[model samples]
Target: MATVSQIWPFERRRCLKAHGIITLLFLDLCLQCVNGYLSSPHVGQEPPYSRDAQPVITSPVVPSPSSASPTDSDGYAAKCPSGGQCNRLPADCINCSYHHNCSYGKLASFSCKAKRGVHCTAESGKQQTNFSLSITCQFCWQLDLSQYRCSNSTSCMTVACPRKCYNATCQVLDHVHCLGKRVFQKRLYCNWTGGYKWSTALALSITLGGFGADRFYLGQWREGLGKLFSFGGLGIWTLIDVLLIGAGYVGPADGSLYI
Candidate 1:
């Protein structure tokens, strides 16, 4: 009972509604596919977003097997001795052997062992394999208050001790140790004068320095001759020598201090 125009309009509206429903369903299907692809792990790729995924745990980087051995500054691997004996003594202990008898001070030497290991380059520019470092230490000792008692008039002074000691007491040479072995034994005063006198040196310098008498007494032949020819640098050297002898600067030619 409807007209043709009304029927056509109704059909067009129904077609439009069906088209909108299909478009909506197709858009929803596309969104679901995109979501599935993003959440799932693919070949050589991880999921962009995943609720079941665990936190990534990476392992620490380890050094190669070739780099396991210890190397020196020059990248040469340190070699151990075959005899199993290494020079573990410190440099100071080794150089103590070269010091003069009754001498005590900070000494230095390059041939001494710094640590327990065979050095790639030694003082002779050759690899040292022997662990035994030849050393001939002079007789030395540390002050032991328990060994002896000091008189009331006896004075004590501090001195630079190469080895550890108590109270910095003036110790005399009693024994010697080198390369971890006792080598010598001799009871001698460390502060021995060796026949040098401070008062005599000062007196000669003040009275007859121009004549080179102090230099001659100190056993300095060259300096004595030079002073004799220069007449003590026209009295200027004489005054300086007097000061030096008085202040204990000019010592005996034998490397011993004045008494």
Candidate 2:
């Protein structure tokens, strides 16, 4: 049997050991509660736990619809059809491409130019010359027909709308004749003779100057025959050519430039 003094000490030691065990159990309960709020130990060591702590009060806050995106005032202007974002766009935005769906190069080109029509005049020469035409009045080229009039209203030269450039009985070279100059007659055509019939002689000179071929152009049978036989006054045709123009044997060819 334990004595009174020994029993008292033994009881005190048992009480202390019991208290320590209770304290350890309380600490373990505290750690279990903290596990709900925080992560578990990474390796093996348990985290510090406060034995005097109490449960915390919490009320979670939620988002509202209006606050979903306060920054977007226009609510995103529907991406540029060009497939671009609401914040960015292709060059063809003017064409209403919200997604940038059009070709990049084509969009850039479309934005670079404007629509316009073609305009022309004799003087406004440009990069596209063939696309324009002269706007000058062409009435000066019209033929006059008052010279062959027999009476106030009766005229041998009728002003037909469309006739040969130089029609007979139509004031015969009225334009140049009024200027008092020599002109071809219908008697013997002068392809190249000295006269106001400037075109035929010029044409003949350009087409037949080499072989004295203009002899045939002027309808001078004798001269042409001689030239063909002797090769252009190689013998004396040149002398004849000089004499004829001086004597007025030849006139402008094609009569009155009718052809």
Q: Rate the local accuracy (lDDT) of all candidates.
A: 0.52, 0.36
Residue 182 accuracy (lDDT) in model 2: 18
Among these predicted structures, which one has the highest lDDT?
A: 1
Write down the lDDT that model 1 would get: 0.52
TM-score of 2: 0.20
Residue-by-residue lDDT tens digits, candidate 1, 201-251: 999998889989999999998988989999998999899999988877777
lDDT for 148 (candidate 2):
30
Off by over 4 Å in 1: 1-190
Candidate 2, overall lDDT?
0.36
Give lDDT tens digits, candidate 2, residues 132-229. Answer: 11111111122133323211222121222232232222222211211111132121112221333334544554455335555566655666666667
